[model samples]
Target: MSPSRIMSRAIVLGFLFFLSAPLLSQSLTDEAATIDQLETRLKAADKEAVTAAMTVWVDRVRSKEAELVALVEKRSSVEGDEKSRLEEQIDALRTERDALADKAMVIVKAAKAQGVDGADANEAFLSGLSTHLDLKDPNALLTFALNWIKSPQGGIKWGLNILAFFAIIIGFKILSRIAGKVVAKTMKASRMQVSDLLRDFFINTVRKTVYFIGIMMALGQIGIDIGPLLAGIGVMGFVVGFALQGTLSNFASGIMILLYRPYDIGDVVSAAGATGKVTAMSLVSTTLTTPDNQIVVIPNSSIWGGVITNITGNDTRRVDLVFGIGYDDDIGLALRVLEDIVTKHPKVLESPAPVVQLHELADSSVNFVVRPWSKTSDYWTVYWDITKEVKERFDKEGLSIPYPQQDIHLHGLPTDAA
Candidate 1:
């Protein structure tokens, strides 16, 4: 994007925020009143309510500076009459914003006086950000302490927040476990055949989803504004997703592969430009062990986007072997020898039967195609053993195996050159 366009976008964002600022500001008085009530409730050992109240008040205070900055940016974008008008609005809001920040510190101090030890430093939104006067006078400290001790509004909500946090976690944990087990058990008993990888993915995703919802609910129960937090989380997720686009692609491909069952562990597959037996798989990549015992890892996207040949997917496989014999050799005898060899092979299946045919006639030799069906596991064994048998049997039976050769026919041309 060009500089002007980027600047324009920033201006528009600022404008939108300023347009909404008034409505947000309108709730200030109500929020302050709510904080006071929650504080009063806290001193009576109503720990959870106090934490909830403080979180609300503090978050609003933290957000004030952000709103002020946005308003100033917007005010700078206008010109002449509009700029002058915005300047007034920005100034008024700045004053209000400062008062709110100071108010936040006061709330923190009151909470601290009540034995709420957690708000020291920046722990309490306003108190940490804004400066408070030191209570150097003994009499002043004693007076504040007495008022706080006697006041119904005081600290001690930390313990309640902890209890609420754990309750949410433990409850969600149990529910997530039960839901996962039920899904697993159902899948196991059902006719639908889902791979272990896919099954586990579903289970884990469900459990995590449950835990996330549980946490959000718990936060809401403690008086925190879950809405704004959720919005922030959504933005963070977008940024993370953009940064991890490659990983996301692999993840999507992995899900597709699992659902389609293009290949499975222990299956010999030719995928991702590599041929090997599938040894392991995850949402990101698949691992293979080659014949030479070399390990290869291929991204799931690479595998899913290309052709996948599952060599051992079926219960049986066909082994094709071609042999050549001299043109003068008896075709029937050569075929009979091949058929005999295939039938006696232990690995070859009889149901599909063995096939031997004079497939093609070449200039110097006749080609015979020997096709045999065998158990997938024993396909290579049958192919190698039968091919070796044919070579030896042809030698023993006196059947000639032809090779390419040429006859010299140079005569008169050679004499003329000489």
Candidate 2:
């Protein structure tokens, strides 16, 4: 019983083991098949993702190329006007673009040659660009500018345009200096205030206007439109002119004063309610120093329009004195005394011939008008000497100088009493 039982158990165990081995082997094959299917699917997904990424990169490169081409067209179109300048700019930009492209191509090829994966190379390029371009620092701006200059878009040309702007500013400054010197020299030789002031004003205004044009030209070089800027300036100038009408009037008057030499420096003039020697004159006002040593400023309009009495215009002047005496005094004796006084005075001019006439007879006195000719320098001295000598002679001769007398009669109460 033990042998048969043991043999039956052995047969059952062998049958069970044989059946489980085929099942286990089949299960192992199924698991291997599933693993192979998953691996194949993963490989296909990787390939698709790579293709999509590469397509995106290629599209980006195409877009960039289109932009560069448009820039090139613009550069070419500008060649006709300011041809030399525009050509220089275009060439510089084209050189910059080529260099960048060549460098980028080299980097890509070298990376690829070194077995850098496509994704890695693209990522590196994008990261490098982000760090280098559009940074907030000046160095970043310069680097970005350099990159553009090397590009086909004429980035270098744009950079040079900025430099040209500074050069234009310098040129304008030089022009201003020259204009100023020219105006100054012209004024200095004229010995006039009005003309000098007007010339200066005109030159300054023109300088500012020309400088504005220079600015516009520079801006245009940098790809900016100057039309609006010019229009704005014109409108602003109109507004300013309207607001400063009085100022313009004075300026015009100043010009007239300069052109017409009515009064010069150090001329004594009575004008604009002021009597003084003209000192300095500008576009707006005339400066004067009065006899009392006071500084007075008068408007240009007053000088140009009002009466300007120049006291010192002539080199010689006349001094007249009225000598009056009593009607009873001897006229012949008076005339003789006056003649002596005139002959003795040193400042009396013999050429003009001094005349003493019995000019007027008043109610109380006979007036003798004594006319004496003298140089302006001797006017005061001769006048004083004649006056003093006349008094002395009249006193010595016992001749009387009369005073005004009013005669009045008192009427008695009518002969009513009679």
Candidate 3:
């Protein structure tokens, strides 16, 4: 309330805090030192030290629990601040005891590990073989490996099992090779409707699948449980699928492409933001060859997720050409010349009857749009041929092709009168 009294109270509180800080720090330091000593004693090979550490650990928990019980009894009697304070102390003591118990359990496990591994009677079948490493004897590894290979009875069953495993693998290898050859020959003889790339991809997939199955069988021959192995593989596959989410999506998209047949091999297509001919395809990606012979690989996810422009999908394609003629040039005459060019080209389709008209008006020229339909195979040929023919015919007829130009306007300044 009063300024002087408040100042005095603040000074007293500050002095108390200063005094308590070092005591708290020292208390923590002492606790840490005690824990370290206890851990050291528990790890020591000496029987007396270890036994004494265990006794102390048990006593510490019992003492804390007794203190908590007394505080709890006091809490039932007292009211208000005293009871709240006693309850808080009880909770703190309980937490401390729980933490101490956890630490003691860790120490006990360490003690057991130091004395004897797999010491419980129920684990007699495992013996000490379940142990991780033996730092005392480095030769234990060689001994264990030898024991696995040669049993106590000196029978060569383990040796024969190893041989059988390799034999099964080699047999599968030979079978897979023979099966692949047979599939190739059969596909060629039967004139399969699928593309060569898809055929090959399918055959190889089957062969590899067979090989994987054979390997699993080989493991079973050596007394390994195929059931648990398959379960473990399923779990591993889930994790790997998550890790390779994009790749799996590509795989799914590839399946959709194979089923839909949007663009086959040797078909020119613009897909996944690239224009190229489909050369090879797989379950994850598509291989393309550009006109310049450069190879491009695109993920099937990108192709399937976007618009696929199959340039060669249709039976015929339109070769669109535009010519900008000067305004002074004869527009009708230009259209006649374009019609002649379209008619003369052998590749142009007659049914479509090539359209030629004034398409756009510009500042300096009238743009003529010429569209000539041609077979898909002759699309590029007709485009190039029509473009070249139109240029030559326009020049012969004295038609002006206007380009971007700026006319200069010169103005003279008047002289000033004196």
Candidate 4:
């Protein structure tokens, strides 16, 4: 609380302030030295040297541009589209490099005009600009391109594109498989006589069309040009069509067969020297499997143009059987027995009564015709049954079934011999 004590405190504070002043001054001196060092380094750059380097760079760019143009032109003459495309790329690169050189020259000129060293000023300016642009410090365009080649969404975008492409392929495959299954199932479910070839053709055509569209879409997504591909296919198709006239005719006939189903699968037909069940029918050929397990392939055109005998078309069929009786036997009794045997047959149709007729007078027998109407499925049984039963019944009734015999008189020869 005394004045002396207050004075002593003030002196201690003043001493401390004095000691701190040297430290502060040293700090200020260090900062000033750093600034001067920066200025000195900045002033040491040679503007003339940088200007010369810039001129050399510009000349190099121009020379490279000229060489690229010449090469592109030569390549373009040798190979049309690819060479032209390469030339375009070269021109773009040359233009970009030229612009970069021009920008560098401008920076150098501005620095020189401001009385600032070109190299150091330009270097500092480029460093600051690169930082702002978030570019690497190499200052090499190739390095820049390599470093920033990808887009902002590069990995995800590329993955998505690839995934989409695969997905489309898989989807098309699945669709094709499903379409085939559906076709098969539909054919199996329906009672119509559809050929395997017809079903396959329909399913395959639809699947191929769907797959073609899917492939085109996927290619477009991946940046492919389908215009040239389509044109090439069209030209190739025209050429092929011109060469194969018979094949085209066959194809047309096949289409006609599919549209107008004269005979279906499993139909027993006689055509093209082949009598068998229809196994497969295609655009080009029809396959028949004979009862002997032999496969025969016949052209669709042959089948379309030839006679087709569908043996199993109707639900019911008529069986004709011939039997003969001796002229000495009772003809009325024989006819009655034949008619009775056919009428009692289980498979014979009663709606139209079975017919028994005295067909013809043969050399030694009275020929009787037995006509029995039976289901198509029971044709063989009914035919065999009617023939067998008629003979047995006539025998039981004491009506003799006759064999061909000749009553020849050897009167002239015998009289001459006697």
Task: Please give the RMSD of candidate 1 to the true structure.
Answer: 16.9
| Candidate 4 Cα errors over 4 Å, as ranges | 1-148, 151-200, 217-225, 238-251, 405-418
Candidate achieving the largest TM-score: 1
Please report, as a residue range, the 10-residue window in candidate 3 with the lowest summed lDDT: 122-131
What TM-score would each prediction reach against the true structure?
0.66, 0.57, 0.51, 0.55
Which tens-of-lDDT digit does each residue in 32-98 have in candidate 3?
Answer: 4454554554443344334344445545655765776667667667776775566556545655765
Q: Looking at candidate 3, what is the lDDT of residue 203?
A: 84
- Predicted structure with the largest lDDT when compared to the true one: 1
* Model 3 per-residue lDDT at 101: 55
User: What 10-residue stretch in candidate 4 is worst by lDDT?
Assistant: 129-138
For model 1, residues 158-189, the per-residue Cα lDDT tens digits are 44666787898799989989888988898898
**Model 1 Cα shift for residue 382 (angstroms):** 0.8
lDDT for each of the candidates? 0.75, 0.68, 0.73, 0.68
What is the model-wide C-alpha lDDT for candidate 2?
Answer: 0.68
Q: Which scores greater on lDDT, model 1 or model 2?
A: 1
